[model samples]
Target: MLKSLPMLLLAILITSIVGIIIISIYQIYVSTVKQNKFNVIKDASITVIDRCGSILPYWLPLLEGLQNFGQQILPDYPFSLMSLYKKTLMPFVIVYVTNPAWAFIIFFILYYLFVRPKSPIPNRPFIRFNVLQSILLFLINSLLGATFRALPIEFRTSLYGLMVCNTLFWFVLLTIIYSVIKSIQGKYAKIPVISQAVRIQIDNQS
Candidate 1:
């Protein structure tokens, strides 16, 4: 454990930083690209679902279908409201609310059961990253709900902060995962934090 301290600390730091960047990018994407909300949501959702391995391919089509639906219906609605609704409603609201605790449960079970066992990439940096991220998100969301009873301004701000953090965290996590996988597969991987953590974890595990 002592020997692994650096990796653990690095993992936490990188995950938090990447998570924030992910949320920021999502905010920027939604704000700037007025027409790509559906596509952006679909892409982000698919990225998360892909982490579940082969059992989740079926949801890919469902996400795509929803994207198609959004593309069709969203144009008729006000852009700002529609973007806000999609961000708040579809990706985060409906999916998150319906599943509730499943993300954390699934993440842990899959990490120890499937990911650790199969040892797909031989380096499970993302496992730790994802674990921390999921926990943080759960806490943030819970806090946001409780804050709704306080001053309305504070509540709304808290809500936005949560969304921003959630979006960015997943974005960075997904990006890191993708880059790590590609690098393992002999592709050019460019995510510095993930790549570094993957190396450390792989070395430690070995």
Candidate 2:
């Protein structure tokens, strides 16, 4: 009873914290939308979405299609390996993408507290690589969203740039998803430029 009591309290505390964060975000989003401050919210929202949306290919069929693009270009195995992805991964990914602001805050807090020390888990190459990858991706997405915002609304809304953005989005998304899956399976994806940068950061930390 005593041990269970502490666990119950901890769970309640976590739930309360999460609820508060969500409420705060909801309020901010509502205020921004209501006050006609779309630009401010749009940049932040799209940046987070682009950063985390990379994980969607693992769960989304359209994204998975993009990842297995070669199958479409060539006669190949009619079955998609992505279908074999663990079903348990979807709920977590969906929640993260849907509430990216909250997800990022919660993940950053947990990572800093439990994974950022000289702990052996922190030293793990795969974990370090992914952390760096996520950070870089976030920065890239931020810049991209900001640049998009600078363009005229008509241009932004036009189908002219849609194809380019769509292609780039899926490319980055699938690449990250592939790396994540490989990491989970105890392998490295070894993406060229990104992998090199991740290695440098991990080495410097070590």
Candidate 1 structure, TM-score to reference: 0.34
Total clashing pairs for each candidate? 3, 0
For candidate 2, write residues 1-206 as lDDT tens digits. 33334533444455455435544565566566754755433223222222222222222222223322322222223335334332423333334344446434534643573246465442344444555566555555545545655777676546655544555556656765666455333344577786688677766767
Best candidate, TM-score: 2
Q: Looking at candidate 1, what is the lDDT of residue 164? A: 46
Report the C-alpha displacement of residue 78, candidate 1, in angstroms: 7.0
Flag clash pairs in model 2.
none
Candidate topping lDDT: 2
lDDT of 1 by residue, 1-206 (tens): 24434533444355455444554564566557843645533333323222322212112222222332333344446889677857643653244335535444544654564335355554434344343333333344345334433436553347575454345434433653554343222233444554455445445655
TM-score for predicted model 2 compared with the true structure: 0.47
TM-scores of the candidates are: 0.34, 0.47
